[model samples]
Target chain A: MTSDGSGFRAIPRTAAQTRVLDAALTLISEHGVSGTSLQMIADAMGVTKAAVYRQFKTKDEIVIALTERELGTLEEALEAAEAEPSAARARELLLTRVIDEAVTRRRAVATLQFDPVIVRLLAGHPPFQQFIGRLYAVLIGDPSPQARLPAAMLSGAIAVGVMHPLVADIDDDTLRSQLLSYTRRLVDLPE
Target chain B: MTSDGSGFRAIPRTAAQTRVLDAALTLISEHGVSGTSLQMIADAMGVTKAAVYRQFKTKDEIVIALTERELGTLEEALEAAEAEPSAARARELLLTRVIDEAVTRRRAVATLQFDPVIVRLLAGHPPFQQFIGRLYAVLIGDPSPQARLPAAMLSGAIAVGVMHPLVADIDDDTLRSQLLSYTRRLVDLPE
Candidate 1:
């Protein structure tokens, strides 16, 4: 679990690669992976298509890197959670960080999770699949069939809670706190 | 409330228009609204682009109609839920049907809600806006800020729960039942 959560951060990128990923993330959030083009990312970054291609040879590489970066953000929380001895406490800690991360990125990360291309990438990408499996192992703890649904719902709730139109006007602090409490309830954690 | 729920169903369309929408939905489900083009829809339907144009003027029109058609499926449930006197009972009824609808359509309907174009259209389009408002109203009968978050989370839970990769292999009956129970818990209704 420790190694799995750390896998993403271990793969370092150059500053130029990071810049391309940042630009691609913005474009993909707005237009989705299927709708966004390499030329558009280059243009957004004020570079030529050749320059973008130099950084990422293909759109799929950019997408995989973007997902890696996003999941990397959770690496620390996951590490801490993995270290914690108590299952309930680990879950609570992870959920807090997860909610905060979701609120901070809001539309960008949540929206990316739903894109069809990204969905396929996440499934096929080995590191992502391993990292997600670790994330859910802590999230569900019990590993029973019944526990899986609530964990799935909890993940969906947090992802959608931060970005849904219904809560768009909510202040970051308010949304984060609200999500934390509601998510705690969903998992039957003491508020 | 009654009329708002029924608005989607009231809009009539020609058989040709429905065919165009059907093909458009399939393409949009795989490729997003922005990724899909009129020519693609026509190609899928084995018709010329001009014939597809005759059904709908622009890509946005096809998206709008596709959304309407999907929402129309929930019209009956919304109407039934609205007529129920008890708030908790109304919400229970709606969530059950929503879970069924989501599990039945699963990927297509859930994926559409997250599309950037559909999100914008649902926000800007008056009928879509009004219908969503009424749906939320029943879901959160309290009409308070506190209630809004749970209602928002409940919606995300249901949408993401049905379509999430983790639950993808779960049978429709199991998914639907699990969603109903977990969603009821999210809203603090008796399970």
Candidate 2:
């Protein structure tokens, strides 16, 4: 992972900062990044805009922080996959975690992943680019250029699978099991 | 397909109307629906806002028209698949057309699918909803609730696969082939 020229350092956030990020994420999910304002975040948290501003001075900072916090959830999972002795074991570990997170934060995760503002932010952010590279490395194992499509498709399937309207009525456990089973088929993992 | 309560009627557009849709799609792909306005569409089309307004009275109508034009592309494919003799053939036919469309208009397709405003429009519009349901029916073949997850995941994989940054550098032919191969595997279709 380190050899990819993208560092995997943890983004540390203070408790107060986390609170602001939490409120911002909730509002952003509903109104999107462009529509969300600091005042809205403050109102959601029942705090003055000044208090929210004390934690993050700008909306861009809050958006970046929220993105980092989301990516940070996968950090431990990435490390666990990296440490595994076998490639297959590593993929299994990482995918299990990815599915779990997707199911747990279904709406918020999809909103963030697909939001136009967030998409632009993630693309330009080196840390995010690095984190995504590491995550894909574990999932697809540095495939040839031609093989990148399947790798991309595999990740896409998982990300969009959880929040897809067809699966909206499905409970977490059933969605998790079916996703794993079908994903394994896509990736040619053993039963 | 009509028996499914969703009629597959073609949306007729004049050359001038298509010009507006083309300009609107281009801007909407870049700025999204909410951020885009009639003035931007007029600028893109080298026409006055009144000229654009003459074609469509409001921005919502333009958005809906753009969406209808896009979905209309799939109507033929869906009809062909519906006319197929076997379930397997229908799935294969539908998937092939889907991959082709996804690769051909990679950016526009993804931008429309994931855009929040477009998502809301699609959900609220009966024709779009009917078209999607018919599309899914062909893809999944009236699956039990447990089976909807794979169906959703399969569709998501295709939708997101072409637009994924990982495969961004890959050409259309390679992407189409790889997506088909992996999607076949996921759906248990014989390659």
Using TM-score as the measure, which candidate wins?
1
- For model 2, the DockQ equals 0.62
Model 2 DockQ class:
medium
Residues A58-163 of candidate 2 have per-residue lDDT tens digits of 9887777666666668888898999999999999999889888888888877778877777776787787787888887888886678657878788779878987
DockQ each: 0.69, 0.62
* TM-score of candidate 1 on Cα atoms, chains taken together: 0.92
Error of 2 at A4 (Å): 18
Q: What is the interface RMSD of each candidate, in Å?
A: 1.3, 1.6
Write the residue-wise lDDT of candidate 2 on B1-191 in tens digits.
12244564547778888899888887776666766889989998888999998888887787777666666788888989999989999999998998898898888777788777777766777877777888888888866896688787887898889888887888899888888988887666888
- The reply for model 2, stretches above 4 Å from the true place, is A1-16, A43-48, B1-10
TM-score of chain B of each: 0.90, 0.90
Candidate that scores best on DockQ: 1
